[model samples]
Target: MFLCGSYVPPQYLPWSPGSYLFLLETCLFLLFACTAAGSAGSMPSMNNQLNELRSLAAKAENRRTETGIPRVAMVQGKIPEHMLAAVYDPMINVILQGSKSMTVGDRTLRYDPATYFVMSIDLPAVGSVHPSVSGEPYLAVSLTLDPTVLSTLFADLPKPVGRVEHNLGFSVAPVTTDLMDAWVRMLRLMGDPDAIAALAPVYEREIIFRVLQGPHGWMLREIAAPDTAMARVNMAIQWIRRDFAEPIGVERLAERASMSVSAFHRHFKAVTNLSPLQYQKRVRLLQARTLMVANAKSVMAAAFEVGYESATQFSRDYARVFGLPPAQDAGRILGDTRAIRP
Candidate 1:
């Protein structure tokens, strides 16, 4: 769960700085396209496919899989509570046997069996998982987003046409019968390792195709088209995560997103529910937690290494976020690391 890969294409260049005039001009000469997805109730066939997906993923360990499938992974059982606070990559996650709640900034969303959520950009979030009523373990699977793959599907699709959404980069939608069937094909390939190299890509496209037909299809469509607000905000996010330790100015970040400082800030917050600086802070804090608990680093050492100027300030912020002072939290989590490390 903590280990996920991100693949961005070469064509997706990082946005440049110092373009205030253009920023105002683009303040959305192009902005966003919005749609609602997944209103259909689960069908009988959806339940059947969902069951197969669960069985295929049943043996997944507490961590990611070793299924030999590229960019596909599953997890079952309790997550190390701490690892759930993370800077999550772009992916579509479907919870099969249990429910999970994800909190991005002040917003929290929950999903249960047969529900999947799409996050179109990197986000800093905290999450918790629960097992099914029958005591079935928490089970889920994920497909990491790849720009190259999504872009290839663009030619066959309709141009995105809809109302503009400010910064809604992630959304939750119910699983449809067709989508579940596609996942069934994708996961069934695991049983025939020899067939994967040839068929995985084929099934992968079908799965994405089903998702593209959904209401949140705009998310998939717009993200592939780099000029959209979601893609632009994604560019700014990559900048923040890349130089997280360095001091960042909102103006520079806005320039990178090709929006005015005010527009940029507004869009960024709309998408991430946090300001750019706050986003960086979360990345830092999450990294610091990993350093202390996993590497046995001291409070000040973890703080300084993650770019905090003052250990005192780090402690205060850490307590605010994690609900414990640095030293105490580290000590408590240290002993529990192995419980979830697998």
Candidate 2:
């Protein structure tokens, strides 16, 4: 038989010291869990806000316009999750919903709900967006950065207090709550046709300001500064992006960058992680891939189009970079596409 006593208060239970410690620890853990849960819960709202922004842009613009001002576009519907091989001219891309991964050389970067990806210089790369949940699909807003405006803004701002350096044009960084809020506001402006005319530039400027103040600010600063080593390398990169078919002499590239031969070599490699010749080869190879897959250019023609003088040399380099000779890589690309299509 058990003798029942009066209810024991939590503070006066048997093994009270141990019980008290356990309760205290349990409460602490619960508190931490709740805090974490709250933070996690906020993410869905952020994604929603981004989605709303994209929706506004989509509703505002009817036809895709090609102009001197790089366009801001919103895409809808089902898009095949495939790699796009092209040069990313100066642009800021914000993902309002879904997510994407971009491959440049060996590195793969993800841009999703909480982040924005920027390409401050021209670069050839491959990019793909992941599929969405519940068929809601992905949403993205792209605003091309105006280099003239960027250069102007840099001159107006006070000189930063440190030496500038060049860096890869592409970067991924977390967008601030303030920046996200600004994006929402800008998107709202799109609904007001009158306001969009007056406000889009203002919003775009604000976005750029947020970028200049963000983690990769120094990279932007260096790119905008005309006399910096990074600026020199950027000029070389631009030349290569635009004229890959031209045989580039090291001295000639150095002259274009306004740097001495050795200085240009050091700075170009430091910024791009590749020498000028290597950079040209990379761009040319990517172009060759595009020509083969999209335009149905033969291996020899594609090679010549990208400035490869010798067919054997072209095949060797193409194989080295793409893991197959031109003919084989072209066949594989076509085969892979056919396999994926319904």
Candidate 3:
């Protein structure tokens, strides 16, 4: 179990405890279901606000940035396709110009400009980004979730009323005008470094507040309450992620979450879309890919390093997830100058 204040990353997302870094090319949380785009008229001329935000976000690159704002980052231009397939960290992502897609199990969810999503759990997501019609590069901004901060917001707000079943790990909705306006204010601070410390938190609270009024607001509410089913599942995800290379069993993980075996399995699969063993396999596969691509480890070595006993089985799994044999995939990535960068 994690300490009270520690950040629990999504299942299958590998974290470097020392650096508190997510070793992911791009980050996202798994949304349980992809609903149709929200009502178009909810926000009049959303593109007006979206365009302003897009201009501000274009300053970022494919890599994530700290940008002097706490728990916020931006990515623009090309993202390495290989990295998108891995599970992701929890975040609120708003696309500026291009489109993004995340495949969780058999379902694929795509979001265009003027849309945003809140993600909170295991992903095993096959994600990709696409350029907009006018040829703009993929551009987006994200707010890394902080449970402590989220919890602070609950005191003043009325208790949210919703069925437990409705509070999934994540969900997508159209970017409300109020939400976009808050984001615009948040990003505008990039040009005014001296003002970030005082204003960033204010703007962040506004963003969270706006989302809390939306249809999926209960999702965020549940994740921060500490004792909710979603939070328990989050705890279980952290347990698996911390010891992915070591073998784990659903029974043990269930006990850790303080839920019965069947309940834990139901909640875990509801949020992550993968069973306990399958989630572990995803973590192993993603780590092996990184070792092979970034560290130049051999296929067999990478397999064993990530707890795979059989090289052939590792190769087969790698091919299925990445759509190519391990060696070939590694070689292809290494050939690209940008892919080799740490």
Candidate 4:
């Protein structure tokens, strides 16, 4: 199962004394550089924030709890090469080390510490991580974006002067010092429970504000506004997600979005990078996989549960998405000892 962040295995430990000393030196250098950059009203480079991010992520690794501060998470691990699929929520990730690649539609994006990843809507994608060989694992901090918070903040900001075209809901942008600083403060709160209750929201707001001020800020604005085209597509997406087990027609989905069939098809594909039917098929297969793993349902049962009338067709579609037939995939995920039927 995918943790909200990368899983931290027990073998990873907190930074050593030597590493702490190095981090101290790095912080000192960053302070001087940031001061110089601030005098010119320019943001400091992201290189200034990597060490602190790394140290903070290291400390919080493997220590995440359900009752911990909500909407905040840390991840650290040397993940193996594996294709995993999930519907990504609206969140921001600041990578401190290593790199990860995500495939949305036909596009593939690879990002590292110098960049921040944002998903402004729920999207399904395939992802894999590449870790360094010298024992420096992938590390990152994730903060879930709250639409209520975005709406409140968007109102106070000045309006955009020009029309912004709709793009895919996911983006990677250069990290700025202000955003990094806010993230650092948020991560630090994990160590002090008393301070978290009072301070986490303030810091989280700052992070959201900084993102709103960035290049893809308009996308967040669209997500927050209920009347926008993107928002309408999102409504249709929610409908599909809720009733994925039932057959849905494009005309009905378009009506839900208050758009013509052709327009709805275009916008849906633009936002999600998948056609309406493709999206539903993906949703069904993912749900079927969950049933196999979480409920230990047999391949035929799982297929029928997800609206598939033909077991052979279900197997073909499941294999196309997950790289394994239904039975073998179910056996692997559920750790079943019986021989998997083809």
Largest lDDT belongs to which candidate? 1
lDDT of 1 by residue, 196-278 (tens): 99999988888788888886788877778868787888899999899888889999889878899988888889888898889
**Candidate 4, position 241, lDDT:** 88
Q: What are the TM-scores, per candidate, against the unseen true structure?
A: 0.84, 0.74, 0.82, 0.81
Q: Relative to the true structure, how large is the alpha-carbon lDDT of every model?
A: 0.82, 0.72, 0.80, 0.78
The residue-by-residue lDDT of candidate 2 on 1-342, one tens digit each, is 111223546555546698668866866787799889999988887777766776675542222223222356555444432235566677877776678787766677888766888887776666776646655556677778888878887787888887856467678898876678777877676557677767777777777888888986787788888788887788888777778899889999998888899988987766665688988888898887777777877778888889989878988897787677777666676775332111
Which residue runs of candidate 2 sit more than 4 Å off their true CA positions?
A: 1-48, 57-70, 76-83, 132-136, 331-342
In angstroms, the error of model 2 at 38 is 12
Candidates 1 and 2 compared: the better one by lDDT is 1
The per-prediction tally of clashing pairs is 2, 0, 0, 0
Task: Please report the candidate that would top TM-score against the real structure.
Answer: 1
Clash pairs, candidate 1, are 36-215, 37-215
Ranking by lDDT: 1, 3, 4, 2
lDDT of 3 by residue, 1-342 (tens): 232234665773445774343322122221112121245544455777887887887779887766779999998877886677676888899988789998876667899888897786656677889999999898889998777678898666887565465445767898888899999999999999999999999999899888888876788877877788888988988888889989898899999899999999998888777788888998899888888776877888899999989989988998887788888787787784344222
Which residue pairs show backbone clashes in model 2? none
Please say which candidate is ahead in lDDT: 2 or 3.
3
Give, for candidate 1, the lowest lDDT window spanning 10 residues: 31-40
> In what order do the candidates fall by TM-score, top score first?
1, 3, 4, 2
Q: Can you write out model 4's per-residue Cα lDDT over 157-271, one digit (the tens) per residue?
A: 8877875667688889988888988987887776788998899889988999899899878888888877787888888988988898999999999998999999999988988
* Model 4 CA lDDT for position 55: 76
